[model samples]
Structure formats: structure tokens, C-alpha cells
Target chain A: MRIFDPHIHMTSRTTDDYEAMHAAGVRAVVEPAFWLGQPRTSPETFYDYFDSLLGWEPYRAAQFGIQHFCTIALNPKEANDPRCLPVLDELPRYLAKDRVVAVGEIGYDSMTKEEDEVLARQLQLAVEHGLPALVHTPHRDKAAGTRRTLDVVRESGIAPELVVLDHLNELTVGMVLDSGCWAGFSVYPKTKMSEDRMVRILREHGLDRVMVNSAADWGSSDPLKTRKTGLAMLADGFTADDVDRVLWRNPVAFYDQSGRLDLDDTDGEPKPDDTSSFEGNSIRRGGE
Target chain B: MPNSGTAPHPSLPLTPEARAWLDTALTEIATAPTTIRTLFPAVRRHCGRAPLPDGRTVDEAVRALLLAALPLRDQALTDEVGALHRYGDPAEQRAVLRALPRLDPEGTGRFLDLVRQTLRGNDNTLIEAALGPYAAAHLPADEYRQAVLKCVFCEIPLARVAGLDDRADAELARMLGDFASERTAAGRPVPEDIAPFLHPFTTSGTTTSGTTIHGTE
Candidate 1:
């Protein structure tokens, strides 16, 4: 069962998490750009973070045998900061990168006027860049936030199919589905949807455009929630093929819209040259 | 120890059409006044990803060409080249590192940090790129020796490392010899290619010069 975690903040996770995720059949992941726990004071900070998402993070993930792709955005919370607005001018350059698959995590946080404007602008950038958008529904007012998110998404004039309203729950799922957009559920440990609940959502939703991710980060979260959900589905009599669809193919289809999802098998350990000088000293032992 | 050959291998030189296209593209970009921030990623679309005769993609070659085309003010050129590598994806980074010898043939040592960064990285391709002609010409002797040893550590062919013959020294040979002994004591067969580098240490009172020793037969 190959799992493609459509949303996981590996920057906040450790190498242990990567190994565990790989051991649990997570072959690929997409780490969306989002605000750190603290507010960033300037756009220069955002540029470095975006560079990491595009450069360092992917390189690190590859070392652990995980193919990493990322979505670039200002993130809703930071969108309110006057200092960070300059990032919008730079978003197109990052958006044009090969590993950047979407304009992401880009919806309302507090649903502020600033968040409103930033979200709309990034959505337009998505449309212009021909990339998909990952819209984050606010945690505080879940129901209202998603509704307003849907309204903003509709008004942005981008195709609903090119949009995914993420961090959804039972209340918002039906509306997002009805809006012709793909639904993303972040299965976390305590707060977000649990594995069994995710399984139940799949059972109800019929696994069309639904994507299950750990959304694991610096907070209290489990990186293998996607795999656990897969197991729960299997226990509930869902076929392996069904698990593959929700876990792998669904995210691939969503990000493939960017025409840049390099799901190639380039994540494995570097193969020793066929004609290396020191054949006895494999790379594994050479370090020692 | 200057690296004079900045052009692609003769066997796989750029097509005249590709060359002309690159000239026009670089001219437009040069006038537009963006360094790597805007133009680096666009190189592939204009240059195409088809393989040249030498097996490197046209995109990679054209990126090098575009980088070398930057205005020749040393500091500005260095800044642009550094930004391109720093912010670039792995492929883009590789293009810049691979082109360093051609871009700075004088061995000015302005780009050692980029080479060092690549050496510190775990990406084997980037490691290979970091050990090219520019690194050979400019990297300090001690660092150069370590970089070569890193190639062995990463299971890369020592033959792929440019300037290996010119840079091979007594200390490097001794290190390879010590490594060979460690493997042999573990009852493992040593790397066949380490023999040339190891030969100087094994033979007493006579060090071979310009022996042309690459690992494969």
C-alpha cells in the first residue's frame, strides 16, 4: 500500500518520523508552506522558509527515501502582517519551481479582511500560474470559515476542481463536496479527525476526491495517521485497491494538475557506481 | 592549475540552432535585469529537456550557458551565481556547480562556499558536481583530498572526479591505503580502483607521476 501524504509538515518533524512514515508505506509527501508557531517579522523570513520548502526540505526527505513536493503560499495567518505582504511579489518565482505543485494552505485563518485579500490574490496567482490551490479552513470558526472559504473560492473565478478545501470535518465535508471541489481531511491524534473517523468519512464519501494526511508538525500529532486510517479501512472490509486510491492516487491526481508532481523512484539510497574504485567499502560502511 | 575547457565536450557540442537560441534568450534576459530569481527556472522551458550527445540534458547545458552569459563584473557575477545555486532546486544547483569551472576559469576562488555546501550535502549528484574542474582548480589541497575521499564514501566513481590525476598526492594515497587496510582486515575485498592511488604508498622510494590510474580496467 503506497501512501502519498498530501499534507505533512516534515520541516517540523524529525528523521525518525520520516523513517517511520516510510516503514508504514508512505512513499511520497507534500509539505505545504505555513506560518511557524510564532509570527514572522518580515518577508525575508518567509523567503527563507519558502526556499527550505523548495530546497532543503525536499533534499532532506529524499535522504530518507521519501519523494517530497511542496505548495507555496503566504499562509493565511501571516497574510495579515503588513511586513509579510512583500512575499506576494515573490510567490510567483517560487510557484514556478518544479517541486512546487500548488498555491497552498491559503484560505482564512481568522477570516480577516487581510486574510480575505491575501487569499483572493493567491488564488488568482494559482489561476495565472496554472497550479492548484489548497485552501485551509480556519480552526476557530470551522463551519463559518469553510462557508466563507467556499464563497471566496467561488468568487475568485478559479475552477472548483482546481481547488481543495482542506482540514475539513463532518459539518463542512458535505458542502465542500457539493461545491465540486476536492475535500482534504487532516487526520491528527486528538483534535482533527481520527483514523476510524477518517475511515467512516471514506465509507460515507465513497473515496472520490478525498485525501487523508497526518498534517503532522511540531505540535502533538502522529505522522502515520494516514497509514493507520488505511489499516482501519482494511479492518472495515475496504479493499486494498480502495486504500491505494484514497492514500496515493487521489493526491497524485490533485497535484498532477500542476504538471510538476515528480512521483519518480528517485527517492531511494544512491546506487553505488557499477565501476566504483572501492567496491568492498559500500556507501553504508564508507562513513564509518 | 587553470581549467581552460569551459565548453561542452566536442563529441556532444550544442547544435548551432540551440546555440543561436541561447544567444537570443540570454540577450533578452540580460537586458531585463533579473538574476537567478526570475530567469533560472525558465531556462529549461526555453532550452528543452532533450539529452545532448554527452547525455546531459539540454536544460542543464543551457543553464550553464545562461550563467556564464551574466555580466562579467566579478562581484555581481559571483552574487548572481551564488543566488542561483542557493535558491535553486537540485537540478539548477547542479547546473551552477557543474559550470563553475567554465564560469570562473581563472581559479578566483569566489565560489568555494557553493562547492563546500554541495560537498556537505548528501545528494550524490550534487557531490559529483562539486568535485568538478572548478573545485580541482580552486579548492584548497586538504579540502580537495577530503572531497575525493567523500566521493569514495558516497560510492561515486573516483574516475568521474575531474582533475583526480593532477590532484592525487602522497597524503591522499596514504588515506586510501589506510582505508584499503581497514576493509582487508574485515575480510572484505578492497576496491579495485583504489590500487592506483594506493600504489605510491605501497612502492618504496619511488612515487609514480602522471600514471593515468582510473579504477576500471
Candidate 2:
């Protein structure tokens, strides 16, 4: 099963995660610009982070055979920070770049007035840039947050089809799907929806505009949750075609709205003889 | 071929339009440090994507222009150049590396860290940029030899490395010999690019003092 994990934080991940993800058939990923655990003191740091998403991170992923693309935004959690507000101004140039696919991870953390302004502005930027927006519903009060998120997305005047309301559950899924927006599920080992639940959601919703990702990051999460979800669907008697559509094609169709998703042939194995290093560091150890 | 280092900013072989755009950009960047942030990426979009006479992109040429046009020197030059590199993406970083030979013509080691950083990374383009005239002149003998061997390992053409013919020493040759033997033992053919470096040649008695690699060589 060729999988395209629509959301995964590879920056926080090790090379082993990439290897295992590849072994599990994950060929591509979209790393949204989310807040790190430590709060950033300034906007310049976000540029460096954005630059890595555009430059070093993609290069690193290529070494492991995954094509990496990213969404650029002042994440919901950071929107409340005054120092990070300037990132919105620089979004235009970053949005113009080839690899940037969407204005993302943009929505309410606490559903603050500050988050409201940032989300509206970024959603407008997405519309102006003719790109999609990855709207993250607040983990706390998700049903209400998803409702507010849908309201904000509607008011921004962006086509609902171009918006993906992510980190969803049964409570929020109905509203997102009813609103004509894409519904994104982050299948996790704990806390978020599990593989069995995801299989049940698919069983209920029938996978029209659904995308399942591990949303793996620095937290205790499995990058192979998408694959696990696929297995659950198969065990529940879904066809191979059904699994492929949910795992691969759904993401391709959603992000393809950006007109920037490039799924070129990626060489997924580490070449045995290749001794190239990044920033002077190599994946090689004593004798390979 | 002897290690004849690159001539500093040999008259750019640019079309009238490209030269005009570069001149305007240099003026803007000189007046405001902030201008480079936008103009640096705009170089390819404005100056055209065609390869320059030195095999650098038009964007790389602007890097040399910025380094040359700025009035800062010594520690100021070092700090400005370092910041320019620190904030840049790989292509921009590659541009800075390509421009370094001309910016610090004397192998004063001001930019040695930048070159070494590129050499450490696995990006073949950045590695190739690291092997430019600046690195060729500044990289220590031991590290230089390892970088060339790394080029062989990564399949980056040995020809991309500057000053190889002049800098190729007995140690590098021995390392390549062992590498070739290993490939043979593994039933793999050796890389063809190493042939020119492996052949025996006497170095001129005059030591190569300069740090630069002329693309023409």
C-alpha cells in the first residue's frame, strides 16, 4: 500500500522513523509549520524554521526517499505571541516558493481573539495566493472549535473544498463534511483517534473527502499509524482500491488544490555505497 | 595542470540586460541590508537562469557582487558574510560558497568554517560548492583529501572539485588506491572520474599559495 501521510512532523523525527515509514509504504508527507514545545522569542527564528522546511529538511527527506512539502503559517498556539506576529507579513514570499503547498496548522489553540485575527489573515493569504489552507481545530472543545473554524473559514470567502479541517473526531467530522470541506484524521497510538476508530469512521463516512495521517511529531506517536489504519480497513473487509484511495489518492487530491504538489518518483532506499553527509554529519557509522 | 587560483571577479560575461539588473540590485542592496533578503532570491528571476561563465548561476554572481560592492572589510566583512550564509537556503548558501574565492582572494581562512560546513553536509551541490576555489585554497591538506574522497563516494564528478590536479598529493592517491581496491573486492567497477587524479604527476617546486579555483582549469 503506497501511503502519503498528509501530515507528519519529520523535523522532530529521527532517520529511523523515515526508514520505518518508507518500509510501511509512506512515500510523501506534508510537514505543517506548527509550534515547537519551547516558545520562540522572536520572528527571525520562524524564518530559520521556514527555511529548514524549504531547504535542509527536504534535502534530508530525499536521502531517505520521501518527497517533503510544507505549509507555512504562524501556528495557532504561537499566534498569541506578539513576537511571532511578524511571520504573517513574510508569508507572501514564502508562499511564492515552489515547495510550499498551503497556509497551514492555522486555527484556534485556545480560540483566542488573537488566534481569530491570525487565522483570518492567513486564510486570506491562502485565498490571495490561490493555495489551500490546513485548519487545525482546537484539541480542547473540538466540536465548538471545529464549528468556529468552519465559521471563520466560511467568512474568509475561500472555497470550502480548498480547506481541510484537521485533527477531527466523530463529533466534528459530520459538521466538516456537511460544510463541504475536507476532513483530516490524525490516527495516533494514544490520545487522538486510534486505527480501529479510524476504520470505523471510514466504515461510517465511506471516505469521500477523508485523509488519515499519523500527525507524528516530538510527542509519543507512531509514524506508521496511517499504515496501521490501512490494515484495519482491510481487516474490516474494505477493498485494496478503497485502502489506496484513503491512504494515497485522497491526499493527492486535497493538496493538489495548491497546484504545487509534486509526487515525482522517489528512490526510497538508502544507497549502500553513498557516503554523502549533511552539514558534515553522515547516517553512516563504523563500517556502514 | 598546476594550481592557478581564480582571478578575482574576472570581467563578468553577462548580457547587457543581466548586467544592468545586477548593477541595479547591487546599488539597492548596498543602501539597505534588508534589500538582499528579497533581491538575493530575485536574482534568478530577474537576471535569468542561464549559467554564468564561471559555471555559477546568476544568483551566485549577485553574491559575489554583494560581497565586492559592500564597503565593509576585515571583521565586518566576515560578520556580514557569515550572516548572509547563516540565514540563506541551500541554493543561496551555495551561491555564497561560490562567491567566497573572489571575496577573500587571500587564503586568510576567514571563510574556512563556511566551506567546512558545506563539506560536512551530504548535499552534493553544496559539497561541490564547498570544493570551490575558497575551499581548495583554505581546506587543510588532511581534510581536503577526505572531501575529494567523499566526492568520489557521492558520485559528484571529481572535475567539480577545484585545484585537484595541483592539490592531489601522495596521501590522496593512496586513499583512492585503497578505495578502488575495495570496489574491486566488492566486484564493483571504480569511478572513472578518479583516473586523472590517480595518474602520477610531479608538483612544481613552487608551492601553491593562493586559495581559488578557476572554472576554466
lDDT against the true structure, per candidate, is 0.79, 0.80
Candidate 2's TM-score reads: 0.73
For candidate 1, give the lDDT of residue B7: 38
Tell me how each candidate scores on DockQ against the true complex. Answer: 0.27, 0.16
- The deviation in Å at residue B126 for candidate 1 is 1.7
Q: Which stretches of candidate 2 lie over 4 Å from their true place?
A: A266-281, A284-288, B1-88, B91-122, B133-159, B168-206, B209-217
True contacts kept of each: 0.33, 0.15
TM-score of model 1, chain A? 0.93
Query: B1-217 in candidate 2: lDDT tens per residue?
Result: 1112233334666667777777676666566655666566556545554566656665566566766666566787788778767766676678788878667766577988998877776667678878877777767778888999998887777877898877887667778988999999999879888987664634444334444532221
Checking candidate 2 for backbone clashes, the offending pairs are A277-B121, A277-B122, A278-B121, A278-B122, A279-B121, A280-B120, A280-B121, B133-B213
Instruction: Tell me each candidate's TM-score.
Output: 0.81, 0.73
